[model samples]
Target: MKLAIIGAGMIVKDYLTMVSDIPEIKLNAIVGVEQDVPTMQELSEKYGIKKVFTNYEECLKQADIDTVYVALPNFLHYAYAKKALESGKNVICEKPFTLKLSEMRELKKLALDKNLILVEAITNQYLTNYKELKESLKKIGDIKLIECNYSQYSHRYDAFKEGKILPVFDPKKGGGALMDINIYNIHFIVGILGKPKSVKYMANIERGIDTSGMLILDYGNTKVVCIGSKDTSAKIQTTIQGNAGSVIVNGPTNVLSDFDINLNNGFSKHVDDKINDHRMYEEFKKFNELVADHDMDFVKKELDHSESVMEIVDMALRDADIQLG
Candidate 1:
């Protein structure tokens, strides 16, 4: 797939770092706004990107690229992905797919009508360790409770305290604890357990945004509490509790480093099923397959999961009275 990358953000560099592993993906162009040309050109020269484009629309008009990777800030995802689909190219969008559910729905419709693959680049869903953890759920019996914590005090927090708002802390930019970090825990739950009965969000609001927060997801038989914070840091751990036993995942949910299983029957095991060194590799590999093969069935399934996630996000924001589009 010849690809046009729309941003020179940190995530774009992450993708470039592991580009060699997936021979199916090819870097065709690096695109950004005129003001970002310097960064884009630097990225182009470094990654051997053949074309540099300041105007995304003009670049999309060309026939050289078949796919666009929208790794821009959270607020730009909808507009950028929409334009990419309108250009008749598949899109690999970074997650939190959109700040609102309606936007995600529109993007999903656009991709389907265009008959192009549209997939969110959420790390957990495609991780080898995550898949194994899901498969091991049966051994843990019926899930009764789940607690997922993904909290990292951003270096940006010090600046935030000084009344400086970066995109990661700006509400207008779709930044906050739940949307930024907790969304992975949201994906971890929604991707595995599907939609919950309902959701409630309790946030530590500072300067009109959630600096830290706890999201509760009820699944009728199971209840989940996900804690995400940008103002604090802790030893990240996720536990899936059941009548039979429990599974504990240590470290970041995004990385899924390794996990442990403890059964009531005195059975315990440690699992390390990582497929690659780069946390982003596994998902992009799936993106390559889906886009190259035109796997609409798989794409639709992913969209379904994405929609469910957006629904929860919508409710969570509503509960906190955090109005965002």
Candidate 2:
């Protein structure tokens, strides 16, 4: 898939680091605002991206690419993805998909109408370890509880504490613990359990945003607590408990790195099956393959899953009375 990347942010840098490893993907161009021209130029030179455009419209009209990766901030996702889809390009947007479920619905409808692939760039659902974990669930018997914690004190938290508001901590920009960090836990759980029976979010709010939060999802037979924080740190771990056994994840939900499954009948083992060190690698690789093959069926399946996740996000935000763009 010939791809035009639409950000010069950290996510773009991470993607640049691993783009070479994915043979099916070609970095045709990089697009950023005029202020980020230098970064774009440096990235383009280093990654061998053939062109760089400061304007999205110019890139859409001029770049020789079939796909656009919307790696911008959360609030920009809908507008940018919509533009790309309207330009007749397949779109791969960063998580949270959009700030609102209604926006997500519009993008979904647009993509389906155009017969173009549009997917949310969530890592866990595409990871090898995540897949293995899903398969190993039966070994643990009926799932009774799940706890996923993905908390790291943000580098910008100190600045925000000092009253310096950046996009990440700015509620108007869709920045908060629930959307930024907890959504991974949401995807990890929802991918396995589909939609929950009900959802609620409890948040630690500061300056009109959620600095940290606990999202509770009720799945009838199973109970889930997803802890996501940007205001504090933790030894990030996730666990799936059942009647006979439990599976413990070694790391956070985003990087489903390694896990241990221990059962009551004296069977236990460690599993580590991730194909790449970078969490974004597997998802982008899958995106490339799907777009290349024009596999709309699989793409639609993922879109449906993403829609469910977005629905839960909206519910969680409403439950907490936290408003975000």
Candidate 3:
């Protein structure tokens, strides 16, 4: 698949780092503002990309491109992705697909109507370690509780405190702990347990945004809690408890790494499937496969999962009384 990238931010470097190794997908062009032209040109020369444009629409007009990866800020995801789909190109958008569930539903409808692929570029769902964690859950028997925590002090928080409200802390940019960090926790939980029967959120609010928050999902007999924070750091881990055994996953939930499982009987096992490349590798590989095959069923399944995750995020934000600016 020939692909065009729409952003030249820090995260775009990570995506490009991985895409360089994947031969099936070609980096056709890059689009950014006038000020970013030099950096884009440097990147284009280094990566051997064919074109660079300051206007995204010009990049979209390229007949050689078959897909577009939207890596812009949170608020721009919906607009850029919708335009890409309408322009007859598959879209692979970054996480927190949209600030609201309503926006996601509209994008889903558009993708279906246009017969194009639209996928959220979330890592955990595509990682081999997460798949192993799911398989290990079977040995744990009936699940009683699941706990996932993803928290790290953001570099942007310093600027935020100085009254420089960048996109990460600005409500208008869909900035908050829930959207930036907690969304991954939601993805990890919902991908495993599906949607909960009821949901509630308790957050630490600062300047109209959630700095840290805890979300509770009640699945009748089973209960799950997801903790996400950007103002503080924690020993990030994911634990799944059940009747017969328990599974402990270490390292960031977004990266595939080593984990251990302990059974009630006395047997213990450790599993690791760490890859050398950045976490973005798995996602691009899967996107290439789906787009190449024109697999709408697989795309719909992923979209359904993404939609459920966004629904939970919307509820959590509403309960916290946090509005996207």
Candidate 4:
């Protein structure tokens, strides 16, 4: 996976830190705006990245890379991913794949047509613990209810309150608790249950964006409620209940770092099968291997799951009458 990162933001820095651990993911180049050249250069030098480009087209045309990682602001996901697909490179986009379901479908179609791997860089889907959690569900009988909460009062929330709107809280930048944080819960649910029968969102709106929200997903016999917030904090946890037992996640949905399963028969066990401490490592390692193998079957399955998640997000936003870029 010869990769060219498309942003110089915090995620890029975080990614650079552990990239060397996966020798398959060669950091070929990084592309950013002219204003970010210095930061990009510094990162390239520190991380041993081979090239830095201030122009996207030049990076796409000249960089010795086969994949692009879209780590830009939320609103830029669709356009940048579309461009990478058009440029004949595989893309690993950050979560909330796109603001709209239509955009997701378009990207999926283009990737299929071009025989390129287009995947969302979501963490839980590839985590070992998350996978084990899914398998452990069979021991718990039929699932009845699921509740996931991933709320952390953002440092930017204070500024947002004072009318200093940054991209995170800005409506036009696809910023909100739902898109920014809750999407992980959506992915966690949708990945396990496929799609919901109905979707609804009740949000705490401030200045046109959701500062916090409760999303209800109806799955016939199962009921799921996902809570996400940028204005409050809580112990991040997820619970999946069944008539015979239950599974409890001890950490954020994004990491699924620890969990326990308890049965009605008094049987219980804790599980943590994670390969790496960093949440992104397992996902990227899998991404690199999949891209290396050109495993479109697995990629397509993930794309289907991603599409379901996007559909739920679109429905939730529409139900709340929240418009975002």
Q: Per model, how many backbone clashes are there? A: 0, 0, 2, 0
- Candidate 3: segments with Cα more than 4 A from true spot: none
Model 3, span 70-135: residue lDDT tens: 999999999999999999999999999998999999999999999999999999998888888899
TM-score of each: 0.97, 0.99, 0.97, 0.98
Poorest lDDT segment (10 consecutive residues) of candidate 2 = 15-24
List candidate 2 stretches off by more than 4 Å. Answer: none
In terms of TM-score, which candidate is stronger, 3 or 4?
4
- Which consecutive 10 residues in model 3 have the weakest lDDT in total? 274-283
Prediction 1 TM-score vs. true: 0.97
lDDT of 1 at 216: 95
Which pairs of residues collide in model 4?
Answer: none
Error of 4 at 52 (Å): 0.7
Candidate 2 per-residue C-alpha lDDT over 18-111 given as tens digits, one digit per residue, 9 for 90 to 100: 9889977889999998899999999988989999998899999999999999999999999999999999999999998999999999999999
For candidate 4, the clash count comes to 0
Off by over 4 Å in 4: none
Candidate 1 clashing pairs, residues 3+ apart or interchain: none
Per-model lDDT: 0.91, 0.94, 0.89, 0.94
